[model samples]
Target: MDIDFLKSQLEDHDQSQLLWYWESLDKDSQEKLYNELKHLEFSNINGYFKQAMEDLKHASDKIDNLLQPLPTEVCGSVTGSSPEELKEYNRIGLEEVGNNRVAVLLLAGGQGTRLGVPYPKGMYNVGLPSKKTLYQLQAERLLKLERLAKQQTGKHCTIPWYIMTSEHTKQATDDYFKQHNYFGLEKENIILFEQGLLPCIGFDGKIILANKDKVALAPDGNGGLYRALRKWNILEDMEKRGVTNIHVYCVDNILVKMADPVFIGFCRTKKAECGAKAVEKTVPTEAVGVVCKVEGHYQVVEYSEITVETAELRRDNGQLTFNAGNICNHYFTLDFLKHVSQVEQENQLKHHVAKKKIPFVGDDQQIVKPTEPNGIKMEKFVFDVFHFAKNFAVWEVLREDEFAPLKNADTAAKDTPTTCREALLSLHHRYMLDAGSKFIHSDGSSLSDIPCAKKAKESGDCQKSENDDQFNKCEVSPLVSYAGEGLEDLLSGKKLVPPVQIVMGPSDITPSIIQNVTANGTTN
Candidate 1:
């Protein structure tokens, strides 16, 4: 093998370690590298190698630029679609609800570190009626959706759940779900894959080696979903399974609409290579990426890119413009995914790094907090793939019903247990009101102020409100609570319904519990 020739050709001023990397290779490995280079004689070695080196440098530069405090444009507000556009989407959604070619790609690699839990994000119980975990809710939704598809179209819907986990939580996550029997879901349909990680670099840009042969690394952000799929050969697996349309989402959002056939159907019917779920911002400055045209091409502008002037832009009717806030729910066809995955492995997409407080050890046996930022945490946004799509579409959805993210600690108040509880109760309250129940005060009289369960629980029985003519001693159960569906069934009769308590995994409803103030009862 021509070792020196190969080394001379590859040595460069920027990468002084190339010589060390070559020296680390044994004779057999050197011969192999020489053979590989000889086989690529047809390729422009100098140009290709130089470009590869420059790409890494350029990516490093992008990170340096990112360090400068991001502008307000990094977040964006939501923009509601016209009523006519919404009507059109609704029509398309209903038509596509019956298609069996859609599947869900759930990103579940995150740990509940922010929540101070030692389990996967999917395992955190939100303290709902059933105590059902996030995974159960999503799994049950797939089950219900499949049944709905069969009932609506008379065709069997096989919606596969493609879950992505990380080295940190793979074994425990799988074991946790298996022990629970996947919450009555089909085990064969659940596919799990592990994402890749890159070594953390020090402030000097040198890779931080944790041990003699291993380096400390972290999961390449959720943006690496495509590469993880390719690395695990999941993209090819999906193709063989007859899945063309993939509805992908993160697992933290409790109210996410999963494997939404309507979204898939709309993408398919419209022939879109990629599509995203978005919501109109409550104001013009909410923190989220906005979908809009960049340099005459469609792209998502991170909030930091939007200035106050850009956010304040309004239409003729004085409504704030630029209102498409990405909810992280996306749809991509197999062909398009294939393209993106290929680019991902080839390092084609632009890379951005973040500097964080990575813990380390000092000579004095104390943990060191380096004053200067060290190491780059690489992340690939799912939106980054949009730039490669031949055609992309954005669909606006109702944020109030579907965008509560379960991130942060309890005190964060964004997606904490308390916040999720409130959101769920709000949904239930609307359902109850739709069923003709009136709100009552503590004194057993109807109240003008809408009663929140947090406050209502302190008062008295929710069913014993004033002006109870609409309900007459009928027993109404949530059949499906915010925790999950198919819980307790509602029983209707002539009398107003009484307050109800729900349980799970038990067939026996103790006589002591329902013995008082109840009416007719029903079971699922």
Candidate 2:
């Protein structure tokens, strides 16, 4: 190690304390610590810390009346579009896919700590019949979508997958995909890349050391995506691959539509350089960020940023003025990415500070976990770049069909494994019904499915009696129906019952086998 250079860098940043124990540590520890310090890139930590500390005091924006609903021309929805419009959009989107001009980007840097797991969140299995991990399900959906596009355009194409990982998930995620043979996807089409990481610091604007040998770090949120992409030449790679439009989404959304044709089609139709997939908020205070114009620029404003009265503000149609709930699903044209990457400092995405109990070297000269927040982690949300879009748009999608996020374990009240599974099963049930399929009991009596559970609850009858009927939750394979399409021939006018797994063979949809579904949601 260059002792003089290391000492100079540390002294310059007021982080020489990292080397305070250097004289006492063995040569091996010295080498480890030196190497860690050598690789750090937080030269602007002081400036960022200063700004974030001020934000914590009061980062108020005066936009009470300036907020406007997403303009009509820039907004489209599955609920609002007519069948003809949807068909046309689907056709246009598939053409882009079949031409290999579309790519899917996944933001999957976070771990599954909230979900009670040590692995990456994408590796989670959400208790479906196939027991598929989030990654596998997304891979299969892409595979199915490619085939669908081919069927529509008569051109076979491979959809490139760009997964953004972090220090915590990079190696494990790479290994998991390799072990699973890329979940029936071509290895060449799947690209896993690491995002940037920022040094975690304390309230006093000093770097925190995880151990005697290392500086503590955290993934630089999803917004670090832009800088990482530029650093790794992801933009150049996308250009070479002829990927004109990119669909980016979070990994935890189990119901995410990978390389969604309709969304891409809608954005393309509107000539949108950057776009987002929004869901109408269920209620005024639903804890979702609203996608609306702030000072004439597109951005997602958090619910807490506005007053309760402003949140409850309604439009002429009685819908909340800020009803476009941000689901972190977005579309970016290649040109948009290029410009955003090369934009001036005033247009760049800014990092937000979050208080966390970061484990660090403590009083006894050992790494310790604090019971309360003791440090800050700087992060940049991917949507923070929306303000840079020259022509932005928002596509509203059905929350139940497109936004089943898996944030926690089954123990959490919402966004749990159980809730995700039920949401999927319920959506598949609706798909079956739309395909002219029916569910019946063993004796031909009509059966109630998970979707009916909500109706039953509204009618005060969700709880089962000693003799009430059990649910026949069915799982629809994505390879069979990417969005409930192409299923009429196999499932139309069919009487299905009990637990069924509707999957497709190499050529066509196979006959589903029936099994008894118990009250505990297991199949017998």
Candidate 3:
């Protein structure tokens, strides 16, 4: 913590005004400020400050035009219309997984602020019957995928799990994983790294100070994944580990398929440098980004950027023409990441501006929590690099089965804890029905076909029929079956009580036998 060096750097960047409130700090506050500055590498502070200034200056001009409908081509033939093509993709994906050429990158740098929690979003429990955290659920899926690859290829392979945390979430997330023993996966195979953070800039293009000794800083955004990979030397590690393709996804997506082989295979088989997993938008006005081409380059256009007429435009098949909603799940070849990491190629990515109500030290040196937005946080999106891809692919998936995100608290109807819980329960209930399991109520009657005389005649209770009971309270663990694939055989001739959790227990059952056994709670 060289005071002279710090002052000189600030002077050089015309940012010496940052020290106006410095002299007012007490001895302890000065020491804290010194440490914070030192840890943030104040020697190189010029670059960050300058970038923030430039971002603030150009923020207004960066709002993309939504006048024209983006030109988007279907990535591949629809799976429903062409099953063989999808089969080929699945086969290719399995082959890649078996060959040990894949890795999973999870973007978990976000805090659960929107969810009204102070911990990492991955640590929030959505009140499932198993009470599993998002991290546990995702980790277990990777383990199951590993087993599936081994079974299909007759070779053992470990898919390395890479998680990108943030300064805000790194320690808490680390402690959580340690407590859960890395969710039953090999601890060494799971790598956790922090994403970069940037200082918040006031509307006037000056950095905001949360306190006399501390500058207000925030995570740089998911797009910072590229910078993080380069900064942390993760790209080099991936290369050494023989990871050819990376499947990157957001941590909030409870249904994300880690290192999804089919997606990796699709990209590899098509010789695409980048691929995005998209789902057809549920409606024309869905508030999700649409993966489309702009002036002949691939990119994601936010819902707010499109005109209502353009959004409502439909194709001959009665589907929204620009319906491929980007789900923040992507595949990138190792070579693509390496290329993007280079200085010359890195500039292809662009930054977006987010306006937020940043609490900061006011002129009176008091922390003020403003009611309205007071500053802008600049961010680069991972998808911003899509235009740099030599060959880009988009794979459409079923949204209901693969895209329930836990984002909001109890307030919102969708993307909230309630919805996420219901989605999981619904999925598990579907799995049970597919597995030939009958739901029975407490009255010893078939839930699905309760006699009118036996059915509860109460107003609200009568409305809650077999269909409602199916998903009332159900949870299926990934250790039991990933994506409900092998449950039919495991639960065959077995009755499962509703409001039960199916988990893989600590018994020496063979993989073949264990694949179908619901160990935790099942009826005869």
Candidate 4:
């Protein structure tokens, strides 16, 4: 059992009490706890705890002098590009997809603690008509994208989906996909690998025990992808599958386009080693990170790190100077990822500390969930590696169409379950408007204008406006049409009412209407 080795290591870190229950545990329990203790990475626990505690002191510091807007050439947007340019980008992106050169990486290690759920966020159903979870929706989108790519490029394609989970969420997430038969995706193509975990430490720099037999551990954030990839040989697997370009994104964005052709095409044409998909911040005080140059290096400057004056700065074109709001969507070259993953310890990304109301077992052998922050969990943000990119590009998308994050439960005012569902519905409603569909009341009154009538609002984001509530309740399944395409065949010249749901056959995505609301907003 290497008793001396274990004792010396724990004693060196002053964490010897971690094995307080070792003698009392049964053989199987002792074996489990021993494995956990062996992989705790406690050699540098003291260093990590000290660094975490010291980081809080400068957490609010601002670097306004170093902050500058992303260069025009490095930034591409739907508003800036002409229709021909966008189409060309989509073609290139689809060509890459059809050639089987693209892969998608989903960062979904978080438990739904903030959302008041005991499972992973990807398993959450935001009250959609189909009651599909985030993972299912994304899987369907990928299926559609593969079909679209094959149709466009005239070649068979498979866009591999790699999801990163954590110790707390891996089993649940793994079982979910298995139970649903991988949501129509190939079981092998959808790879599930776990990110690294770090031990949570209390104020005294001592490791907190979840119970007498276990340490309180937390996932080391999305930034741990680099290390995890190396550890799990994920990069080698991607290479084996012939994936050259990777699209990495968070799993919480309900409107996230899976392996978005526009984003992939933009980065491919620019030959960028790394790229970010961002939304223009309409409000200067919006609580989102800005994709800007920090000290001449491309990085996402946190909202808390920028001064009010810096955020409020406007350009000659009457746009916010620092407008590229990061959405945790990115593209990376496989070679660049490999290079980053192999860096030595000195050049590793810094781990940021998160203070939380950690749950732990007291000396009295009872579990206690603290109401106040009692411990720190060290993590690395995925964006922290931006500075390592030699050629970085930013693609701007409409906020309403591409970036409604799901974080909190329905109780929160923003980024809640209700809000996420509404965002997807509103975007689809606008898609129908563009496709020559009209929203009609039960009595044949107009609830919304037809396509040609909306001149000033070309993007169809007005459906998300505070005054309009009808458009927010409708839903268009991803299988029917991805990103509003192919809707013309179904919704063109059609009259639809509020709270309608447009879906297709589960096994086959042929255009079909599933349900429509009556006068009382419920289907008969």
Candidate 5:
């Protein structure tokens, strides 16, 4: 827009102060700024600017309130555990899957910046034996689940997979999936959508320009899922597809069970509109959010918000009172999401401010990267809607089998690609052992030659030996078994070589087992 129009619009919204730097810009810069403003719809931009100003003014008070310890209660009442309970949950979940009442939503908006990669996090390979990207692994899991549901129900069904991408990672993610042929899933069953983004604001409550032509912006956070759902009409789409429950998860988790039936079944059986899968915190001081009830409403309390005393509190059974660690895996009924997305209840979710050193153009129109935090980015978390759920459920899961996240670069000690890879391999090794398969190193030595064997021998722990494999690696395909169950018949009496990948059918088994046999062949 021209200067006169811009001035009138700003004046009409009482935001004339934004024009302070307008005259200082060169012709090119002026055009760029004007185009950006126009694209952002200058008429509605003042409200956001006003909100940002107010947010900046109250940010300090908000931080103080967020720091205060929340009153937490034991989560056991809403938590489910035990194999028998899992079986029941599985039954219910499978029924839903058979009835085509389930879908999977993957939160893949974030880039692999922490991992020191410029690509999307979903495209990063954690050095798996099959060299599968996160997206590919998740897709394969969904395909396997679909097959399982069909087998049990004796009817073909499709579980739609929805992936949320951010502006920064959307194109790269789309191209990656296209290059991989949607990882063997039917193309029509996969849906990819971009999440919303909000402009970054400086500490002084002014918008920061990333360069001469662009404004600094970031994803609106996972809580934007609600808004995105409504914006994309996904709820209506789900209804048309007969989807009742959504398995929501983050892309960083390498061991996530996609569209897990047990989780869905458990929530349905309990008549819960929302459910979360939580793993017992490894220690009282672990830097993970704890799922607990605060003021009789379900919410996750970050470790920073809890006192040392409360963090260490234990129950009579010797488990930590607030042991349920929120792992970002949740099951939400379509109706619950619809309720949360309604216009009247939209404001129930709150925004969180994150301080960061956002790169921006200086007064000289040159880009400057600060060494310290220079701006604030406001975000909304997906879990903030927990309080709106009238009925909520929490399920306890084993961390080792279900929760390995790839979050950092190799320099970090935990949650790095190396650690995630090791966790995947170790879990596969355990599955092989459970199926009565033996392992041997390249030199024909038993796996006991590794360091884990010495510790297992000292402690006389058979279970430890089963998973110890410092000198070996194994990877299991979800197509073979979802949770390492029912593999005995396929693997019994076989000697699995190190660094093997096991998939469905004998034809796909890798590392060349000691004996290759068909249904008609007998083992030596």
Candidate 6:
């Protein structure tokens, strides 16, 4: 932390960037750094460096210890509530929008190399017509949710969007949002924090120093959310901001409900420290973690751990013993977070090991080669905190509209751009049908007597002659539907029909150009 000592260390690594960082520090920040170094003054510089390394290793190790399998299930049995018993939940969920609160925490630190893009995953445009990048779409969701919360609660329930970035993504992520004016979000409310990194290890688990002064480190994985929250002092910040709960989800999920109020209200009503939104497994083979009581506590068991017995567990009525699945969408209470942070015995969270390819510089520091899965990187799962909770709950939701993970390149089987596009299109498809739009038949024949199509049905009224084979069989879905629609289609719909370009909230869909759409078409 000492300026001179830091300079010497930077020189040892021959990393010019650290010098730039030091020079960029303001007076107050520099003074704070000097104070932090005061305790090290008695030790030799090398000893001080070694001590720092030890502290980091200890913290990382503690996290690793907490991940060990639990001895008992802390979560109670899943409620098999009948429709009548679930009335209150349905009522509260539908009755008010703003009455419940919402917050968005995006884990978006990695690049889009898997997706074959040059930018961050958030910056990758999913081939939509509006050309909205992942970040833009997500930011828009946050803005709309903020408005809905305000309208429903009659109070300004600010939707503070927290983005956790890594060394690889912080600058690019910030610059993209900055160029777009944070997409109309209040700049102060959009918090960005850097995730902690663990030193990269070789195949033997020995730390690989990037240079004489620093060890190469990688983002501790998504499970590192808690530590990132702690290092950034986010819990205190949330409490100070009067944010009672936080809805945490990842950035790659295009269909995630940003800070969904229903989930928040449910957690609040149940007095639960954690709330997880889940989807029933389509089948036993589906690749999703199951939310179930482990030993005796509520936890998400990885699909890999589910043996035939566990996966086949069923009650007398033939219902799945573990029906709820972990979608990674969660809600957590602020008070619980404080308690966990304060309790040292409960402080260490267990870590999951993930193997990844890491880049390493050679002895000359000239040529760098990316290594193969050399070793496992330790990280704590956010759900591992479930054990610390006194109460827990899971809310079931539709998977098609809520879960789609983008983790591969265009070449990968499931995560390709084709699949992402289809997923978005599928959401749009459902939204349109719900809006009373029918799909065009292959025969170009009408499935229903839609007013717009009816008016254009006359012979030669549109393009092809009515008598022509193409004319009688051609059918097309409505142009304007939902978020990921092509802008060209929306424009065409507007010019040819009444209203197009529908925008959607968490629970409802309306025309993006609402006033115009309503004026031209009949409003119920």
Q: Residue 39 error for model 2, in Å?
A: 3.1
Instruction: Give the per-residue lDDT digits (tens) of candidate 6, residues 1-524.
Output: 45677656545544223233334457776565445333322223333234444544554331211222322232222244455535554345323335433456778777787787778888877765345666777777666655544554566656678898998899888898899888767888889998866655555434454443344566777767776778899887776776667778877876776776556656666777887888776466566777765545567776666555556656576756666778778888777766665536234665555555655545554435565665445555667777676687777776676777788987678866656655665565445444444433334454332332335646546543322221112111222222323345333322222122344433344435421123224531
- Which candidate order results from sorting by TM-score in descending order? 2, 4, 3, 5, 1, 6
TM-score of 4: 0.92
| Model 2 pairs in collision | none
Q: Report, for every candidate in turn, its global Cα lDDT versus the true structure.
A: 0.60, 0.84, 0.76, 0.85, 0.76, 0.58
Tell me, by TM-score, which candidate is best. Answer: 2
Steric collisions counted per model: 23, 0, 3, 0, 0, 15
Quote the RMSD, in angstroms, for model 3.
4.4
Worst-scoring 10-residue span by lDDT in model 1: 62-71
Error of 2 at 15 (Å): 1.5
**lDDT for model 6:** 0.58
Better of 4 and 6 by TM-score: 4
CA lDDT of 522 in candidate 4? 61
Structural similarity to truth (TM-score) of each candidate: 0.73, 0.94, 0.88, 0.92, 0.86, 0.69
What are the runs in model 4 whose C-alpha is more than 4 Å off?
21-27, 343-347, 450-472, 518-524
Task: Estimate, for each residue in 221-327, the C-alpha lDDT of model 2 and write its tens digit.
Answer: 99888888887889899999999999999999999999999999999999999999999985997899999988888889888788778889898889988899999
Q: Lowest summed lDDT over 10 consecutive residues: which window, candidate 2? A: 463-472
Error of 2 at 353 (Å): 0.8
